[model samples]
Target: MKILIVEDEPELLKVMSVFLEREQYVVERATDYASGLSKIANYTYDCILLDVMLPGGSGISLLRALRDMGKLDSVIVVSAKDAVEDKVQGLELGADDYLAKPFHLSELLARIKTVIRRNNQHREQALEFKNVKLFPEDRKLLVNELEVCLNRKEYDLFYYFMIRPGKLVPKTALAEAVWGDSADQADSLDFIYSQIKNLRKKLKDSHAEIDFQAVYGIGYKLM
Candidate 1:
């Protein structure tokens, strides 16, 4: 999963980034309100860790802006402010959870997982599309109850497609969703084609009922 950490304290920011990265999350950081706003406006994330007191503005304002833009990304307000009003304001403005400073990294991880689960209430432990089933917790895929092994990238790509079955997914969006911010550095989308090819072969070999159809020069749609 990918997360955005909006914090001004350099040490805390670095510590959170390292801890979350070690836990296998793709971590992105912003030092202040402006940078955080820019990142949220341009990209999507599974979760956002927001610090209330920021250089340019309050994290409350950023949360308000996010809601104004109709972005429902799960937000956890991580701040030193433990005041009741602060917490109330954050919750009222759409933050999914709040964590005060001096908390354990393990606790933060637990809260992150909880908020993400709440945000994705529509998706259960196992995601099903046609005859294929994806166990996200185990990173396992099965067709007709038979396991179909896939590498990390292949699984990520296939899962991305599975969630949006029958919908056309643009190449750039797919790359960003699976590869995170690093996808911006790619010169072309040839890598997506290669990944799709491998996933297609795997699905076909497994006799899966669904398939991905290329959209000529645009993208692909899972059908």
Candidate 2:
């Protein structure tokens, strides 16, 4: 899972990043509101740890902008002990959870899991197309009841395609989903075509009933 920690405290941010990394989450950090907003605007995450007080602006403002953009990333507002009103307002603005400072990291971790789990409950349903069966929770894929070995990028590409079924997925969208914020810095999106090419070969070798078909100068669709 990917998580963004929007905190200003140097120590707390480092501690949170290290702990979450040990727990196997990909973590990113932003120390102030401007950077936090930029991160959310450019990329997506499974959850965001937002601090109520930021150097440049209020984290509550960032939260509002995030929701205003129609981004549904699960958010947990982090605030100081006396900032009760901020916490309340954050919840009103659609924050999934909240934590007061001087809080237990364990409790914070629990809340993160709770919110992410609640949000992703709908994805628990296995996705199947033709002979391919994908179990999202298990991160496993099978074709004709046989496991299909896939590298990390290949699996990510396949999952993105499987979720939309026959819908055309633009290369830019694919890059953003797979590469996250790094997509913005990429010289070109040709890397996406290469990743898709490899994934297609794997599925074809496995006799997958569904295939990714290119629509010259446009994108690709599963058919």
For each of the candidates, the C-alpha root-mean-square deviation to the true structure, in angstroms, is 1.8, 2.9
- Estimate, for each residue in 1-223, the C-alpha lDDT of model 1 and write its tens digit: 7799999999999999999877767789899999999989988888999999999999999999999999999999877745677789999999999998889999999999899878975569988988999987678999999999998788878877777789999998888877787687799989999999999899999999989999998899999
- The estimated TM-scores of all candidates read 0.92, 0.82
State which candidate has the highest lDDT.
1
How good is model 1 by TM-score?
0.92
Which segments of model 2 are wrong by more than 4 Å?
Answer: 18-27, 81-83, 100-110
Displacement of residue 96 (Cα, Å) in model 1 is 0.6
lDDT, model 1: 0.88
Question: After best superposition, candidate 2 residue 107: deviation in angstroms?
Answer: 5.4
Candidate-wise lDDT, in order: 0.88, 0.85
lDDT of 2 by residue, 1-223 (tens): 6789999999999999999877656688899988999999988888999998899999999999999999999999999888889989999999999899889889988998889878874555678888899876666899998888876777777777887889999887777666665675688888878888887887888898888889887789999
